[model samples]
Target: MIEYSTLKQTGRFIIILGIQILILNQIHLGGYITPFFYPLFILLLPFQTKGYVVLLLAFFTGLAVDMFSNSLGMHAAATLFMAFFRPGIIRLLSIKTEFEPEVEPRIHVMGKVWILTYTVMLIFIHHLSLFLIEVFRFYELGEILAKTIISAGFSVIIIMLTHFLMGSARKT
Candidate 1:
């Protein structure tokens, strides 16, 4: 039988992906900020999840977004890049004794400041990699920076809100 946590995680993954594909995909704010909260799925995984598993999940998640967005492999590439750096970022942000078994990197669990920092760094990396891959032009560096900053801001906000909502729901 499937474990409860596994079922919960699968449902959460489907919901996040559906929201990104169906809802977020349709919204284009000034054509500059395309929020991608799908990364939150990767961010909130259990702390003990294997590195290879994270990479695989990131690839498939971003591939799904690419399949819908038709941006080729930009999302997949960006997400994989972010996943590659996830362990390092976690180490930088955490003390050696910080994580307990089954703890996730959620706002309520890890506190607001830590979550904010974690989200900001990873989202910036994801957005920068994504925009760079999408444009593939160094001459347009200014525009790429503009899009990455603005879009990362929006994505971070949306992802934080998701954490707050989900964290509170778990509390009740």
Candidate 2:
């Protein structure tokens, strides 16, 4: 039988993925700045979550987005890269040497600066992988950089706003 926590996590992933594929894709604040929140779901996963499980979920999430957006494998590659790198990033940047099992990566647990830095770094990587793959050329490196930076910044703002408003700042 699936555990209750697994059920809850599945639901959360579905809702966030739906928002990304349906709502966020339709809204363009500009030509360059489109917010993606699906990464926030992965970012908030329990600190001790198994690596393979994270890779699987990130794969599914990216595949879902790719299906809806018809962007081929761009989302899949980027999200998978982010998932693969998540643990190292957390360990490298986090202040806490120890955490309770199932600790959620939130501002309350990781503090403002730590969480902010963590989120921005992953978002930048995801965006860079995505935009650079789409562009597929070094000549337009400047454009790729601009798009990645703009989209990542916009995504960070949206993620932070939601966390503060919903009190996702709390440790879970």
lDDT string for model 1 (27-47, tens) is: 899964778989999999888
lDDT of 2 at 11: 90
Instruction: Return the top candidate by TM-score.
Output: 1
Q: In terms of TM-score, how similar is model 1 to the real structure?
A: 0.94
lDDT of each: 0.89, 0.84
For candidate 1, the 10 contiguous residues with the lowest summed lDDT are 95-104
Extract clashing residue pairs from model 2.
none
Write one digit per residue (lDDT tens) for candidate 2, span 54-92: 999888888888998889788899999899889889889
Q: Going through the candidates in order, what is the number of backbone clashes in each?
A: 0, 0
Error of 2 at 113 (Å): 1.5
Each model's Cα RMSD? 1.6, 2.4
Which segments of candidate 1 are over 4 A away from where they belong?
none
